[model samples]
Target chain A: MSGLAETFAAAAQEQRGVLIGYLPAGYPTHETCVSALTAMVRSGVDVVEVGLPYSDPLMDGPTIQRAVDASLAGGTRIADVLRTVESVAATGAATLVMSYWNPIEQYGARRFAADLAAAGGVGVITPDLTPEEGGEWLAATAEHGLDPVFLVAPSSTDARIAQIAGIGRGFIYAASTMGVTGTRDRVSGSAPQLVARVRTVTKTPVAVGLGVGSAAQAAEVAGYADGVIVGSAFVRRLLDSAGAEPETGVRAVAELAAELAGGVRQRRPRPV
Target chain B: MDPLPDPSGHFGRYGGRFVPEALIAALDELERAYQQARGEPGFTAVLDRLLASYVGRPTPLSDAPRLSEHAGGARLLLKREDLAHTGSHKLNNALGQALLAQSMGKTRIIAETGAGQHGVATATACAALGLECRVYMGEVDTARQALNVARMRMLGAEVVPVGTGSRTLKDAINEAMRDWVTNVADTHYVIGSVMGPHPFPMMVRDFQRVIGVEARRQVLERVGRLPDAVVACVGGGSNAIGMFHPFLPDEGVRLVGYEAAGEGVDTGRHAATMSGGRPGVLHGMRSYLLQDEDGQTVETHSISAGLDYPGVGPEHAWLRDTGRVSYRPVTDDEAMRAMALTSRTEGIIPAIETAHALHGALVLGRELGPEAVIAVSFSGRGDKDMDTAARYFELLDGPP
Candidate 1:
């Protein structure tokens, strides 16, 4: 099994869902980003999704967009993202890169796959790359022994879910709502139904993302999901702490990650 | 001739669904509604009635002898899409999508516009059909086309100015897509151009193709032969695609699309995607685009707000690759000069977007000589563009 599959297997043994924390590769500055991801890992983040800051982020909420803008303004490139994956993966957490589709295609597919593998990265999660458009990426990932994680939404029909389940090598990402990436006041009531639908279709581990912001919401999602993914919430913490001491922002993110990890480890009604 | 776009909405690997998975069911529903609407006379009757009575279909083809003289002596004919309601060919698409959305039980309409023509057209359609309308425009474009902002507001549409990433047409499109993703259940996004994922590119092209279909017959009746070349300006390529599709069967006729080169393509500031670009995906379609080495979309500039975008329509990308049609660029100065010349020679003030085609015709006229016939798609009028034109040409008797 690849490192990602093994990571999920190890989490399943512990009777707990994995806690995935995400932050852009270069936000505020490259050094601060590395510090934040390391802090998040030290606080029990099991997987790291190093975001590749992009120019036009259509699927993001305002907070993520503002953070990404700062990241891009700091001159983050694909090289920076791979370097980040290498460092964070050294902490023993499975590391994946969440990106929009264009940068990967522009940075030659084969070269990117090989370089990422050399960096000890696990896989890639493409929000815009659909199965119909993922033929090249699928081949590239398989050749590199990397997982090609795809997203399923609440709007996905059963047949679509089945197709995705059959193809998932890494955990499948289930968007809990039609909303973009932002903190929500409540965990979506319909998210459990979507997770139930995905479970019926595949043995592959499933993760729920989008709007899971707090410890309470993380605990709620851990009831059914195999992984609890937090993106904007982590970024939000760092953003709120900006203009303070550098270590202050890092500590804030570490604190949130520890709280979320506790929620993931909570005993739930559903079994792994 | 190849029976495209395919069932998956791809035209030779360019157009397909590249949207977030949350919007797939809605896209599938739209495709079904559109495909069924094409065959049912009940649907056609309503669409046709709207085009004929509401939009003034079968717009006239005017002889332009004086304007031809201003160009290099070739006989020039103007396809007057400017005469259509809402002052551009945008109405052709807005009405069709509105009717389709109504049939699908979608009560809310959303759209994005750069020049405000499409937004005005969409707002007009919504008013006529009694549906809720909301439009997204770049903050820059809203200020540039403030008259159109008032027009949309007066038509009962809420105009939202997008203030993100360059704050232009592409940003407006991104904002609209976000809105669609969040509210796909009861809303229909009326995409303005022949861009976007799947059914949108094909659907918009079909509705706008009347420009070419009517020009084909009218030219044959008025000029006694098909023009040697057909020209139109390309933004997201709706007007150009609409004016070129029906002429594809006429292999002898050359179809040319003129893209806006803000300064010039070599300066790297222009929106000349086909002229200076590589194939990449944006706004849900893989098309020729202006992107940096890292694949991030580059900032694009154009004197014409409509053409100031980094990406072109997917079908245009396919057409460029297959060598079925040719594309060229017209600089801001050249387009403005053409706009003024046309106004003086033919008493027609063409939209700056359409003036790009006019400039291309002037160049084509020089190559074809006096005996050749050229037909140009006058995509819109200059009423919405008065502010920009006045500033550019110092036509306002005010301080510079």
Candidate 2:
């Protein structure tokens, strides 16, 4: 099994949800990004998604958008992103690239797949490329032995979920809400129902993303979802601590990841 | 060749719903509604009535006899889209989308504008239909086209100034998409052009097809046959695509689209997507776009704010790929010269965006000879361009 699959299987055996952490590549700086992810994985994160920053991040809210913008402004290139992934993957966390489709399409799908795999990255989660348009990318990823994860939304129909399951290689990413990525006051009431719907279509592990921020929220999702994916909250910590010491920001991000991981471990599925 | 976009909403390999998962259901809903509306006669009747009475249809096809003199003996006929109710061709699409929004039981309309022409048009349509209206404009554009901002506000629309990433048309679109994602239940994003994802490119083209439909019949009536060539400016490419669609079946008519070359195509500072770009996805569809090696959208410069965009419509990209239409770049200086020449010769001023079409038509006319008839999409009146034109011509300095 792939490292990503193994990690999810291990967590499932323990009756705990897998904890996934996200950070944009080259955020703050390339070296700092690797350090932060290493710290995150050492403490808790089972999967680390290193974001390849694009200029127009349509799916991201203000928090991730600001970090992406700053990364772009700092001259963070695709090479930098790959380097960050290599460093993070060395820490034994299954690493993936979360990006809009254009960068991969522009970088040449086959070339991107080969480069990413060579850099020790496990897979990619393309937020924009649906099953309908993912044929070429899927072929390329398969050729390079890289997992291709896809997102299924709360608004997705049953037929669409089935189609996504047929094409997606890694665990399916379920957007918890019908909106861009951000920390909300409450997780959408539809998230657990959406996960249930995905299970009806495929036995693949279902990970809930988009609104899992705090430990309590992660625990709430852990009750139903196979994995808890948090992004904007980690970015918010880094952003909020930008003025303080760099070590302070890194520690805060790691500590939050650990706390969320604890929530996933403590909250066992209620006799399901 | 295959009835525009296929069932999957693809224009060749260009157009698709390359958006976030959150927007998928909304796009699906929009596609279903648009398909239903396309079939219903009542919808067409309502749109037709609104087009004829509310937005002013069948705008005249005027012959620019004096302007033809400079076209090296070729005759120039202007499809007077500039004379529409809102002084531009933007009203045609705005009103159609507004009516569609109403049919969907949506009460709020949101749109993004470049030079504010689309904003004013959308605002006017919303006011006419009693719908809530919001227009997103780039911070730079709100300053460059302040008058149009005032025009939109006067028409009872709120203007949102987006201050992000170059602060131009592209950023404005990003903000608008964000708003739509946040308020997808109650709000309808009445996309301003034939760009955006799926249904929008196809839907906006259908709404604006009135331009080519009328122009084709008028030209045949006036010249006793189809014009030898048709020219229009390409921004997000709505106007150009609208003027070219009906003429596609006529094998003899040549379709040409002019993109704004801010300085020159070689200067690396132009909005000429066709002249300098590669195929990539941005703002929901796969199209020809001006982007860097990392697929980041590049900043485009053009004197005409309307033409300062880095991407063209997906259909335009497909058309260019198939050799059905040709796209060329017109420099700022050349477009300005055409604007001045048209004003002096025909006693009619054209918007800077429209002047690019005029410039393209002049070039085509010179090549096609004296017996040739070239139809140009004079897309908007020049009233909005008085300040820029005056400054460029040094008329603002009082007869230099």
Candidate 3:
């Protein structure tokens, strides 16, 4: 099994869902990002998604988009992202890169896959790359012994789910509800159904993301999902703590990760 | 040439769906609705009638004898899409998309605009069709093209200024895509240009191709032959593709597209995508894009808000690669000069976007010499660009 699958298996053995955290590679500065990500892992995040900031982030809300914009402004190139992955993976958590497709394509699919694998990264979750346009990416990942993750939206048909699950090597990223990446007042009505439908097709673990803001929401998602992913909420914390001491930002992220980690552990069984 | 964009919407690997899975269902639905609409007499009849009665179609190809004489003596004919409803060619695609949305039972329409021309056109179409309309425009564009922003509001559409990523056309597109992803169930995204994912490029091209079709017929009847060259300005390349597609089979006629070179092609700020960029994926299509070594889309500048974009239409990229057409850059100064020249010589004020093509006609005219008959796609009028023109000519002080 891939490291991502093994991470999910380990979480399943704990009778709880995995806690996933996301942070742009070079928000504010690269050193601060590494310290914060390391803090997240130490605080019990089972998987780390180091964001590769792109100029156009269509799926992100204002908070994440602003953070990404600052990251790009700070000159966080592809190498910095890889260096980030290498640092975070040293903590022994499953590490993945979440990026738009253009950067990877520009980096040469084969080269990017090979470099990512060498950096100890386990997978990639590309939001913009559909299966139709994923030929070269799929080949590169397969050759590099790395898993590729694809997102399944609430609007995705059953056939699309099946097709995505069939080729997806790691856990399927289930975007909770609709809309871009942001915090919402409530969990989506469609999350449980999307997970259940995904269950009928592939046994690969399902991780729910998008709009998961707090520990309570995390708990709610963990009740049905194998992984509870939080992005904008974590980004909101870091963004708010942007100018404070580096330790303050790290502490803020650590506190939230610990809270969310507790949320996953306290979730009731899947009600099976 | 052999009816491009095969069943899957791949124009030789340049066009396809590169969007997130969340928007795929909407794209599929649109493709289905459009496929049905094009085949049914009920749909085509309504669209055609609207084009004739409302949009003032078959806009005349005006003869510009003085302008021709100024361009080294080539006979010049301008396809006056500027005469269309909403003062631009944008209404052609907007009406078609609004109609398609109505057919699909969608009541809300969303769009992204650069110069607010598309925003106004979409607003006008929605008002005519009795649907809710919202437009996203870049903050910078909103400030520069405030006239169009007001026009869209007067036409009953809500204008949302997007404040992100250079605050330009690409940012507006990003914001609109976000809104569409959220409201896909009840809304239709009317992409203003022949860019983006499948179905949009094909559909917008089909809607705007009426320009070339009418121009070709008009040119044949008046001049007794096809023009030696056809020129159009390209941003996301809707008007250019519309003007070039019908003439693809006319092997002897040259197809030329001019891109906005803000200062100069070498200046990093210019939006000369095909002239200065390489093939990459952006805005849901694989096309020639202005991006950095790390693949981040670079900020682009142009005097004309409409042509300030980082990517071009995928079909234009394919055509450039296959040598079926040629793309060059026209600097901001060149377009401004052409805008003035056209107004003075032809007594017509052309949009800065269309002025790029007019400048291309000047250069191509000089190259091909006296007997050459050159056709230009005058895509929009300069009414909305008066502010920019005024600022450019220093007429801001009430013209002295």
**Model 2 spans > 4 angstroms off:** A268-272, B397-400
Q: Report the number of backbone clashes for model 3.
A: 0
How high is the lDDT of residue B149 in model 1?
A: 98
**Each candidate's interface RMSD:** 0.8, 1.1, 0.5
DockQ, candidate 2, comes to: 0.70
Predicted candidate 1: what Cα RMSD to the true structure?
1.7
Model 1 CA deviation exceeding 4 Å by range = A267-272
* lDDT score at residue B321, model 2, on the 0-100 scale: 98
CAPRI rating of model 2: medium
- Point out the worst 10-residue segment of candidate 1 chain B by lDDT: B391-400
Scoring the B chain of model 1 against the true B chain gives a TM-score of: 0.99
Fnat of each prediction, in sequence: 0.80, 0.67, 0.88
Residue-by-residue lDDT tens digits, candidate 3, B1-400: 4677877778896988889899999999999999999999999999999999999998999999989987899998999999998889999999999999999999999999999999999999999999999999999999999999999999999999998899999999999999999999999999999999998999999999999999999999999999999999999999999999999999999999999999999878799999999999998999999999989999999999999999999999999999999999999999999999999988999999999999999999999999999999999999999988887898765535
Q: Give the CAPRI class of candidate 3.
A: high
Task: Give DockQ for candidates 1 onward, in order.
Answer: 0.83, 0.70, 0.90
Worst 10 residues of 2 chain B by lDDT: B391-400
TM-score of each: 0.98, 0.97, 0.98
What C-alpha RMSD separates each model from the true structure?
1.7, 2.0, 1.5
